[model samples]
Target: MTPADMPSVNARAGAAVEALRAASTELKIGVARGTSGETVIDAGGREVGSIAAGVKIAEICMGGLGDVRLIASTATPRWPWTVQVHSAHPVVACLASQYAGWRLAHGEGKGAFFALGSGPARALARKEALFEELGYRDSADTATLVLEAPRPPPAEVVERVARDCGIAPERLNIVFAATQSMAGGVQVVARVLEVALHKAHELKFPLERIVEGMGAAPLPPPHPDFVTAMGRTNDAIIYAGRVHLYVSGAAADARELAERLPSTGSRDYGRPFADVFRHYKGDFYAIDPMLFSPAQVVVTALESGESFHAGQVNLDLLDASFT
Candidate 1:
């Protein structure tokens, strides 16, 4: 492992799960061992997950390489509740761990189970092409994965995960949170910085140049309807999420990055994400990949001590989506 990645993402995430398990009841999350012996965490599916639970879950999703927090900000009074996120290791924390790039599937047809796994376990699984680019791998006696499914995964799937992660099922933990749950909203909204890092990577900006990063986005109320809830959480970022990146690069490069990093650059920028999803017939791949970034940004060129700004908050779109 690289010096910056010394601790190993899985090891850090394992520490987080231990803490989550210790305070499961206070966090209002359901914790139980599956038949296969893997620990299952119900952040919202079986129990009403709280915002505090979401914050901790978000941190775990980053492989505990980052910090996630909640605060009330007059910065956007109309959407007062917000989630703030930061990481000293942006590339490792956001892409290697939190990007939800793992495609896990079991069975066939209607009975098939599928979820894009996130969190620290991905570092150990090395399932995505992303890990190749990262050139980093980790091993831990314990593993933790965060899933957005509405219910516990099949025991077969959990066993597969443990095997892939090279750990005993008893040493693995799976965290489940549905998009419509309150805790779910916080976890999704907390991806503001991860979204920025992802877009920056997509933009082909130098990941090594990203020295430090921070982001914030409004936390919308979770909707009972899955589509609306997903829309609100996504719109919270695409309409008002803000990010600041400290990069070690030339001013021109920084300015170019700032201009292209915001959601406004996408053809699908103006509408709520749910409408965009319907327009594309529910195929996420059909939407412009550029649409997944924060709405506002500041990219600083550390070499030149200059910062470039781009994008703006669309309160109208925010209100339309939230209400």
Candidate 2:
């Protein structure tokens, strides 16, 4: 081929080199030696390159990852976020309150919203420094549980005290104290006795004799429906096991102590004085540890109208006292 007709080597090579340099700069490539000779490849910052043997350096330099360009469209966009703290315990509630307190102290946002009546709620209220001194805006507080009834500290009261403190009666959230006895004990054991009677019947024992043995003597012909209803609730998760029993009472020497009773499918009838204690440990989360023996906790879970089966337990509602 004539020199004039053939492409000019220097001009073609120069043009190719210039094009490569422009593309390499855009790709942020660095010079590196490969099979044929030195060539331009990936920048070697965050990416690596592989080339075929005998290939010319110019050929390998021809391709690279495209430049990354950030596009600008909207100047500002709105983003919204929210938070929730779900807890029935005073301690956990307290932690959430402190978190809110920190946010308020910083004045980070427009305003703070919170659910009141967790232990933390009371703790936050008690912080006179925040409200009285610093003047933090008070957030609305809602009571989770409240109760009202007319009764003196008990007929056996020595001195009377006002139920309401500095807090307004309307603002005050109240929960009933389980009845206290003359001995300062509230024994809710009648249900346990009734359960045992029903179980005795299922075990093929005489229902009448079992009922008579369980305090039927005092009442003049007690309602049979009461016994039947008790039996049904017991059967339907009021107790564990097809034949589970719950024994409880603070009476130190009750003849029907749990320890003396036979073992149940879901309980340890010895050592712990109540079947509820056994249930509490077996299904810990289903019962509040602070208010019940693991056993009592379990019993409460069973007594809970909610349905639960083996290996599944409820998230637990704290006893009114704790929450």
Candidate 3:
């Protein structure tokens, strides 16, 4: 038998599955590094292919909301803010880009980094400059705040940015070392927290209470953010194991959207998912109420050729990310 067909490979795969199960509670999202044309997400922190950067960002956005967004255009669309993902590691740029778009839609303000290699210091400067170009003030005290992550800014670099942004070091909330993956992007997670805080305050709620709800004992209820939903959709399309498809923006009119989806495709019975609804959009899928995570929902749809739709509601459920 070939080496791959040996017991060792199966053992390793089994171990990886166990690890994934063990860490599933802590890991809400993960980026799939395509291995041998097969994408397998593991929780043990190893297996399949390189996990790469941006998994933290994906997890945060997905946990916060049911979907994520993509740039969806050749040129940068006019937006309120922009965050550029700098890949200190060259090969992970695509994964990083996927993460960045997903995070941005979740109201964290993110953009994609074109160059990938060493020299994050230089890359960060460019990101800051892009933020300025998007009309955000250089100062942190301004209405808009810029956040970076997964990588720490050196003391000098931090000092320089603080000075330029007119903010003190204490104002900076850098989760330098991630509680999960040591090399994972805590800074990005911190930024997501920062946005959540801003959202909580805007909703006239306590940030601590919101966080508590997210990390409660039995695992918090599904609090889907529209922005996060858009981001998650993008991620679902990209790293999904089977089919990849387009997703609508949270703002799309429901009836109008319904009219657009072409109802055509052979309905397959006995799909492994909760509910396999047929979409006129050429055989779309919807999730059963049982599936909580957007990633899972998307994965199920991709595998089963089903399209996802939120009944005829006003999308009010997507409050967190929409506003």
Candidate 3 residues lying further than 4 Å off, grouped into runs, are 1-151, 177-323
Candidate number of the best lDDT = 1
Tens-place lDDT digits, model 3, residues 86-109: 211111111111123211111123
lDDT of 1 by residue, 203-249 (tens): 89878889889999999988999999999999999999999999996
Higher-ranked by TM-score: 1 or 3: 1
Query: Per-residue CA lDDT of candidate 2, range 1-323, in tens?
Result: 21113222222223433453455544433333323222322222222211111011111111110011112212111101101111121111112222122111111254322111211222224333333321222232321110111111121110111111122223322211111211001001112222333333333332212101111000011112322222222222222111122222222212222222222333332222223434555453453322211111111112222322121111121111111
My TM-score estimates for the predictions, one after another, are: 0.97, 0.17, 0.23
Clash count (model 2, backbone only): 9
In TM-score terms, which candidate is top? 1
Which candidate, 1 or 2, has the higher lDDT? 1
Q: Show model 2 residue runs off by greater than 4 Å.
A: 1-169, 175-323
TM-score of predicted structure 2:
0.17
Roughly what TM-score does model 1 have, to 2 decimal places?
0.97
Q: After superposition, how far is residue 89 of candidate 3 from its true place, in Å?
A: 32
Judged by lDDT relative to the true structure, which candidate is superior, 2 or 3?
Answer: 3
What value does the lDDT take at residue 128 in candidate 2? 30
